[model samples]
Target: MNTETNILNILGEQIKLGERKEVNFDVANLHTASAINVPIIIERSKKPGPTVLFTAGIHGDEVNGVEIVRQLIAKGINKPKSGTVICMPIINIFGFINLKREFPDGRDLNRVFPGSKNGSLASRVAHKLITEIVPHADYIIDFHTGSSGRFNAPQLRIVKHNQQLRGLAKVFGAPFVLYSKNLNKSFRTVCNKLGKPLLLFEGGKSFHIDNIVTNTGVNGAKRILFYLGMLSSKFKVSTPKKDCVFIEESKWIRAKLSGMFKASVKINAKVEKGDLLGNITDPYGKMNYFVKADYSGYIINVNESPVVYQGDALFHITKKLIR
Candidate 1:
């Protein structure tokens, strides 16, 4: 083997600077008496710089983020100018293959961070990510989408008090930025505890890909890399045409009655209180229940699925723009 290949032995895999290398992370599969190897891509730069990690498919059905990472790799993003870019296009491989949101064990991987080695499937996967993958990065981007049947306006969801993370969110240049509260056992919460800068990108919807959402994610990622001084001028970072609007609070409009939902307003539409957002009708179209906004804000997420149950989240509204 050559010198570079010899180095691969040290890293347990052969990878070269400016070239894409695939690493299969082994996770135990008890039922099959085998191991599930999650695929990871690492692209290193010849010059030294900070390492940034881009992860997608935390919810396996969210395909737009996965596509964003794939496009980045295909478009020569694998060749960084000064730093390492580690992309895990599909982190929830089991869930991705099953087209489900959670692991086969019915556990949400995002909620079980810094997990135990001998825990459940989700916990084990989380353990591997926190231990083997996340520690090597200076910053992290966890990509997501609205849950299945819902669509979100491309936005960055960050903590309300972290100025550093807030700055990074602006650099991401998403049209809408939400200062969201951290959830228990979430990746965001763990990162915050570790004092790592981790930003969550939410857009599009699960099980499908939208061009606009994918473009926003891809461009936003490039902008972040440029801001971090990882990409040189040759990469051509584009400036945002408009300023990002920040919202500190958001509320979800829920269905009053179970029925067939038909949305009248789309994602990113500005609305006033009592505005006609959508209507829920019975199966035979005999009864119609008009759903109205409870607050004056922008629509960041809307349910696209036709069927909904009573109390089901139908629309997500953010507070009026501050800027």
Candidate 2:
């Protein structure tokens, strides 16, 4: 992976060693006929090393992930010490403009990986990204967040039994490491098929930017670069507050009935069997149903919406842990 080529050809532009360039990843025009050009910020060091790609905003509403990548660029963190660093702070500009998750045509961009050039609008963009940008990255870190109202604790999601990813995730030092299967046609799956090592980060929630989540993401990126000998000396990497908990299996706790929901337990908290997690109550205070833990485990996600209907997910708890 570390061939250390002097020139990198990406998106029809050649970036030489030690050169900094911002390339436009043009896909399609907006409804107003304005050209949509997603900026790809590339920074190369005079010394050669592995190329790292930091991407966010695959789902436009995941602002926390975008903020993390933005801070990397704004603080010159993308300026590597050795190798190259590419930052695509926002991928879905259409959905970003509308403050939505999917593309303007209502297609989930993540579901159309290794896309066809002559397919739908989202597919074209995905195809361009896979063909033009992704091939150049030696390591990829795609940031994301929980969908809907569920807030995910800062975590790195990797497939089970990948020793390489396990080591990398440990070095990244997030609060949690979740072993999950890759979704079909997901970016991670396509990258894996192409033999690129990618780390999928999940934290916070859509449309919300929490400072802690942002810092965790940024710090994790720095740690990864440092481990790869790409991070500049100016940045100081901090050790995680706690050892990352490796969750092997997890389950969602759902609401039994419709009501005003309030969580008494915080996210990432450990709970015992039958512990009071929260309560679901009728608006008129006629009926208050106490929500308790069915099994003891760490709460990885908590639904924050005030109102919830029957069968709405209330919490994500770990079912099993890996020692």
Candidate 3:
């Protein structure tokens, strides 16, 4: 991730210190040969510091993440006091354009990392990202949202026992820090392999934007920048309203019967065993089944969809906490 004191080369462009550049990360053209532009916004200070990269919209439907990164640029937060701040607000331009989560071919861009140049369209983009962009990043913060109709409390996800990540997660100061393993072939895994520190933020749900979630994400980014001495002088970092809850383990509560669903509780709600979390009912009103927490814990995720099928995850509850 090292770069020269005077020059930073990204996507075949040489950006000097104190220079600003908006480079397009173009991969392909549309069927009509219309070129798609994936803009990479870069800001560099004359003084030397760490290069932090902010990214979002790997999944097209995850608009909340996109909004957070957009706020950073629009607010001039990406202009660091020292070093460089890179923003690629939308990576999967195909999905972002089509309003789908995956590539036009239905492949998850995240699942194909360190991609091949000669591979599928998604793979080529991955390859370009890993090869062309990621090498310049000393730190990376990737934003994401819950899939389908699941609403997630603002949180950071990192594997357990990595002290570097553990400290950075605390610095980011999201509401919750969940210890999860890096999935193989994922963006996190690839970045980890390349020795780039990454903080993965998950909030809200797909195809939706929440103001609170957006603020949490934006504030967390500012905190990290402040910690790194990269935040501009004009921006003020806010103290987290509460201490981060470190979840050591968690489990998903699944639906026992398929039916109309309604959650009685909200995300981040702490519940006791047997507490009524929600209920399911037949459309005809002939049957109603109360959903209760099987064990005492905090709810990190709640399925917000009105209708669900049997065995669908209803809630994600914490099983253990890091004291």
Candidate 4:
């Protein structure tokens, strides 16, 4: 193809063969009376191959994903062995600026996919992603973390019966691979409808960067690129020390009473049925309520915040099986 016919991104920036370009998606903001431009980094290889997309910061407070993309760029994603690598480090700029999970309109960006151009702010952003970005990707990796007050072990979540996507999830090499039903109107569901293979990574806690989780995400991305032939096989990336645990069922352990919570176990800890996971106590230490596991499972997530209300989720447990 001629240089004049090179791929042009949403901002009308030309991404020629073997070239790396940073494009901006400018969305006019009426509420702020300003224009908000979201940054996107695109790297194209001279050789033809699959187009992979990496998106993070959908919840704004999910900083580990953003850092992973940033580190990948710093390590030179501009040069690839084959295909294109598109990185949208921060998708929810409004939420990111405010250090929150949802948009200023109180809408969760992840819950509104394939949105309309003339819809609400969250919808518009989602529309831009589905139209401008999703169409270009053969595979996608969406990065995330436990929402505020929670910590998740580095893991990958996928649909229960997608064997193809499940294989890729294993190759990404997180400690755990969770199979669950997709939430309605989520990015994953939209992409699945479009026949795109996408995987979601959950790790660390919102607003805080955990080194272990961040490193796992960075290495996992590199491993994925290597598997896709976009990176050389000789590329050195850390592999999971143990085989990824596949969990088909997971449940959240909620607080039974309102009080201060003290967790006895951390993420990735193994516990038997009725094991003590944590405890809730009054401010004066007069009353104590022990929280125990309902079944034997691995602790995938733990609430880090001390304060808790009745029915607040404090632990996310995935069923464990005996080999």
Q: Pick the candidate with the highest lDDT.
A: 3
- Pairs that collide, model 2: none
TM-score of each: 0.92, 0.99, 0.99, 0.93
Candidate 3, residue 308: the lDDT equals 95
lDDT of 2 by residue, 209-228 (tens): 99989999999999999999
lDDT tens readout by residue for model 1, 1-323: 01122122212666555556878876766466767777787877776677788999988899889999999888876567877888889988888978999999999999898788999889988888887777677899989998868999999998787889888988999999988788998887887787778989999999989999998998899999888778756688888877898987789999999999899998988999989999999988699999999989999999999999999999999865566
lDDT of the candidates, in the order given? 0.84, 0.93, 0.94, 0.86
Q: Which ranges in model 1 have alpha carbons more than 4 Å from their true place?
A: 1-20, 29-37
TM-score of 1: 0.92
Worst 10 residues of 1 by lDDT: 1-10
Estimate the Cα RMSD of every predicted model relative to the unseen true structure.
3.7, 0.8, 0.9, 2.7
| Clash list (residue pairs), candidate 4 | none
